[model samples]
Target: MQEKLTINYTNDLHSYFENWPKIAGYLKGNKQKLQDAGETCWLVDIGDHVDRSRPIAEAFRGKANISLLNEAGYDFATIGNNEGITLDYDDLYHLYDEAEFRVAVANLHTKTGKDPSWMEPSWVVETTGGVKVGMIGLTAPFPDFYNLIGWDVQDPMEILKQEIGPLRSSCDVVVLLSHLGIYADRDIAAAFPEIDVIIGGHTHHLLHEGEYVNQCLITTAGKQGFYMGEVEIIWDTEQECITGKHARAIPVADLEDDADTAEQVAVYSENAAKAMHRPAVVLPDPMPCGPYEDSRAMDLLTDYLRRWTKADLAFLNAGVLLDSFPAGAVSYMDIHRICPHPINPATVPLTGESLEQIVNAALQPDFVSFPLKGFGFRGKVIGKMIYSGLTFDITGTEAKPVAKNLKIHGRPLDPKKLYTTAMADTFTFGSLLPNIKQAEGKKYFMPEMLRDLLLEAFQEIEK
Candidate 1:
């Protein structure tokens, strides 16, 4: 007789809770169908289920996400960058303390030469027909980010090599819950032929019908809980060796909502709304416009960054502040609404020539005014580039910079001198400016997001 196993998975949820009920509803219905037929089934998540971008996640530091996942019946899971490096040590330490599902991450260990008490490298589950299956989870190894947050992430390759060898002989099929993006997924498939399936996430690439690498079939459901993945394994019960595999991504948009799960979500949503309404600040009068120009709020934030980082200069995009200051009653909730991204303050060193190019590039008519999204930028538009510790004389109409002669700390720009400037990391990778891309010795400050800095800046303004 042939025994078939079904695995349903989601990846990169990032706290888009509005769609959670819908996805959970579908999973519940599917689980019942599989159970009634006496077939074996499992539900899993590849990682990134928690993100501070949402109020519920930000309030409880991902504890809410863990609870929600547990309520929805996640059987197994892994960690992604959002879950790995974004939270402080204590928060992460206790984040999964209450989780009911098995958390498998072979590559992660504690910084003090001990593993997290709740973490396991691998697990073996026996099927209804007594066939054993092995599973391992992996998170991305971004050491710099992890280090800042007081955690250490090991190399996935090294961990996989050590973990998979034992599973090869102990299990009929091996599955990998991978959060290392597509390149790493391909590499794992090539290097480890023993792994029968690779479920992936972290680049948000959608694989509708799955892809095969060597003997492994890989699948991903993309990001935002919009899709779910399925892996079907047909095993011969008697032989326990001969089998076939299939994987696919399933859309959940049209799926009916389960009433019970929907009720749970509504309760959580109401609680979150009430908690996020805490006060931030009280503005007696509205602050003037221009977050990038000479406006009060932008200038204040840029100056704060300069002083805080001790950089030679500081720059920021105006649109970082989303809404205008109303006449009165500015609260933490209001500030959060205006600046919701989980962006941190970063400083990069650049040469004087590179600085000129950066300034000039930022002043370009189309460049400064562009509406850019992604890369941790949740603002409306680029607006303008606000700078501190620098001065420039402009001569063009429409505020376009022309014949620019710039100075730093009352001195003219030196073509050969290196100056450390603080700026948002969003501009460091893209072609926003040559200087930003070519910056050297970049230092990123974590745990203290840009919004946190903004609140500090506002406090200073109030003082």
Candidate 2:
């Protein structure tokens, strides 16, 4: 006798609800047909299902995402960076409180290194024919963010080393739910031969027919529910071993959606909208956020950030604010709609010479108008650089402006003197701001995003 084990999964949804109904329908429909045909079906989510950029995810703090997963009949789920570090400690700890599915995270724990009751290191499923399959879930680690939010995330590789041997010995087939990106999955496949299948996410690469590396099958269905991943294992029940492995990504854009699921999502969205409608502040005047032009809102935001972080100077792009708040009672929904990036504030110490270089570079049209991606920016472009406690003259041509007569706190900048600077944490990563990226003594403020700061700043108008 033989058994067909179906592992269906989704990853990096990131609160893209427009495509979720179809995905949910596909997963549920396939599960019913497979199980009705006497096959074993296991549904899983590879994480990042909860993104604050969406009103439903933000308003309920992820409980709604759990309800959707439960409705879709997910058997297991893992954490991505969005699920792991974006939320506060308590929120992330209790995120899956009502999740009917098992939340498997092998490398994350509390600050005291205690495992949450909802977290499982691995999952073991026994098929009807008695073939056992094991799953080990691992998420990408951002130790600094996790630490700031009162959780400790260990290295995924080290945790894998500890858990793989045990999981391998206990089950006929082994699966890895990796939220560590495509390149990391390839490396894991080559490093861990015992891993029979690796279903991945994070970098959001799609493998239509799956990629085989070192006798291990690696598969992923990009991001935002564009495709659904399927991995099948042919289990020989008589021998109690897995004889074959196959994987494929199914496109679901034009697929039929479950009416009930769609209705439920609409209901959730409606409720979230109502919840987010709570008043943030009453604005006596309109505060426009013009990315390419000077905006009082951006200026005030920079000033608030500098004061909040207690830095000598601060600066951030005008584009951080996506829209304007008209004169009236602005709701939390309005704030989130306008400034939805899950970005944090940070302070970096730099010498005046380095600061001058960064200012000049930032003034460049390419840098200011860059359609930046990653590092947690959820906006269209960088826009104009708005400064607080600093001013300078641009003397060169409009095409290539050169910053001169730079002053910090009403005095000329000293080349050898170091100053504490406040900025969005996104600048600390990559080469967009090389001097800031290379600067020392960088401190990040977590849990609260830039939107939170804007909310507080908007209240000042009421006063």
Candidate 3:
């Protein structure tokens, strides 16, 4: 006799609740079909289901995501970088305290020596036909970011090595719910031949059909909820072993919304609108500026960020200000709406050599024009890197700097003097600013949104 089980999963939803009704409707319908046919099935999510981009997610701080997931009957899940690093310690600690399903991640540990009550390392579940399946979860290890949030993620492979041993020994088959993307998933499969399946996300690669690595099968449904992944496995009861496996990305774009969930979404949409209705900045007139050119408001902000950190200089992207403020009353909510990104200012110390590298890198068209989606950047593109305390000697068609003369309150560049620079955290790590990468001392300002500095800029400009 042969018994079969199916696992359905979604990942990287990122608070895209608009399409969620369709996803829920499709899942509910398919789950019923599977139940009616007497086939066993489970629904899971890899991670990144909560992002601050949506008003619901921002207002609830991830609890609302858990509520929606519970309503849809998710069986298992894991954490992604968004869930791991984006929230403060207490919020993330209790983010899923009320979850109805299992939340698994083997590598995370709280710095304060207390584990979240809702987290689990793994689980053992039995199918209707009595096949035992073991599942473990793992998240991406981003120490630099995670450490700031008071959480530490162990080496992914080390955790896997320790946890997979027990699951492999105890269960007929093993599965891993991975929020670590395709590269890590492939590594896991190659390292552990005992694991039968790997469901992946984070890099958001779409796998129409599952890929095979060593003795394991890997599948991903891409980002958002446009597609859900399905993995089917058959076990031979008589032989006490697995016989076959298959997986696919099932489209659910046109599916009808689940009636109850749809109503709930409508109510939430109204609430979200109310949440977005607060005033941000009171501009007396339209303070408009060009995309490529600098504005007084932007320059003021760059100056504020630099001076606030006592950095020698500052470089900020012009696109950080989403909309120009008309001169009047700006509220916290208005600031949020206008400059929605969660970016914060960071300061890094660099020598004259590294400073030149930073200026040269920011001058490149690619660095200025790159469209950045993640890293808490809710903006369109990086735009121009507005500078403070530095003047350029231009020699190119588009004001490209031939020589950058770094100064302090109008002094000449000193090659030996270490200069601190305040810039977006996005540029600090990537090649966008080569000097930033080479900088010796770096300090980060956290939990402070760029809009906060913008408000200060508004006040300074008004004065």
Candidate 4:
């Protein structure tokens, strides 16, 4: 006799709630169909379901996302970087307290050598016919941020080496839920042929039809709940082995929205608006922000970053502030709307010469206007570089400024002297700023995002 099991999954939702109702509807409908056909089915999420860019997520610290997952009947899930490092350690530790599903991620642990009660290294499920399936979860190892947040994200390959053997021995088939992106998924599949299926996310690559690498099927749905992934495994009961496997990312855009889920989202949005309505500051005058020109708001934020981190200097992009701070009462929601990125403040030690190189690179038209998507930046462009604790003499035309005679504290910048400089965490990773990325002695401030610092800056100004 042949028995089949179906797994439906979503990844990289990133708190895009508009399409979630359709996703819930599709998953529920398919799950019911599989059960009616006498097949076992499971609903899973690969990760990145909670992104604070959405006001609902920011207000609830991801609890609302957990509620949505519960209502959708998710059976298993793992953590993406957004869920792992964006919230404080305490918040993440309790983020899944009320989750109805099992959370599995083998590599995440607290700094003091303890795992959260809700975390599982792997899970085993048996169908009605006694076909056993084993599953394990893994996330990206961003040590810099994770360590600062009081969590240690061990190497995924190392964790797999320890867990896969035990999982393979216990079940007829093994599955991997990976939040480690596409390149790592390919590598894991090639290295572990015993694993029958790998569901992936983080890079947001959509594989309309699953790809097979070394007899391991790899699949991923595109981000934001527009598509849902499905995998079917055919098990032969008489032979006690698997006979077939199929996978695809099914489109959910055309599905009808679940009325219950839509109502839940509305409630969450209303609650979030209320939570974020608290007054943050009272601005005496409107502080206008611009992408290319020097602005009071950008300068104030840059100066605040330098002072808050106690660095010798600070630099930030004008684009970080998305909107102007209107006169009168400023609310937390206003600040969140203007600076929604989860980027933290970081200080890196660089020599005067390296700083000069960074300034020169920032002055280039292409560098200033580059549209960056990742590295925790949720802005349209890099924009003009705003500086604090330093002055530059511009000798070129307005279109292309050439920075010269750089001075620090009323003296010429010494090329060989090392200085600690502060900036947004975005520049510390990507090719946007090579000198800062390669700089030594980097110290990151966590549990407080740039928006938090902006609030403090405003408070100081009000006082």
Name the candidate that leads on lDDT: 4
Worst 10 residues of 1 by lDDT: 287-296
Count of clashes, each model: 4, 0, 15, 0
* Residue 139, model 4: Cα distance from true site in angstroms: 1.2
The segments of candidate 2 whose C-alpha lies over 4 angstroms from its true place after superposition are: 236-243
lDDT agreement with native, every candidate: 0.83, 0.90, 0.82, 0.91
lDDT of 1: 0.83
Candidate 1 TM-score, C-alpha based: 0.93
Between candidates 1 and 2, the TM-score winner: 2
In model 1, state the lDDT of residue 175: 92
Query: lDDT of candidate 3?
Result: 0.82
Model 4, range 255-330, lDDT digits (tens) per residue?
Answer: 8999999999999999999999999899988999978889888888899999999999999999898988999999
Runs in model 4 deviating more than 4 A are 396-400
- Cα lDDT tens digits, model 1, 217-336, are 999988888888899999987776647889888888888887887887777767777887877776667776654555777888889988888999999888888777775667666777
TM-score of each predicted structure versus truth: 0.93, 0.96, 0.93, 0.97
Worst 10 residues of 4 by lDDT: 394-403
**Reference-based TM-score, model 2:** 0.96
Candidate 1 regions exceeding 4 Å error are 288-294, 369-373, 394-403, 429-438
Give me candidate 4's TM-score against the actual structure. Answer: 0.97
lDDT of 3 by residue, 48-82 (tens): 99886667777778888898899998888998877
* Winner by lDDT between candidate 3 and candidate 1: 1
Cα RMSD to native, each candidate?
2.4, 1.6, 2.2, 1.5
Which 10-residue span in candidate 3 carries the lowest summed lDDT? 394-403
Residue pairs in collision within model 4? none
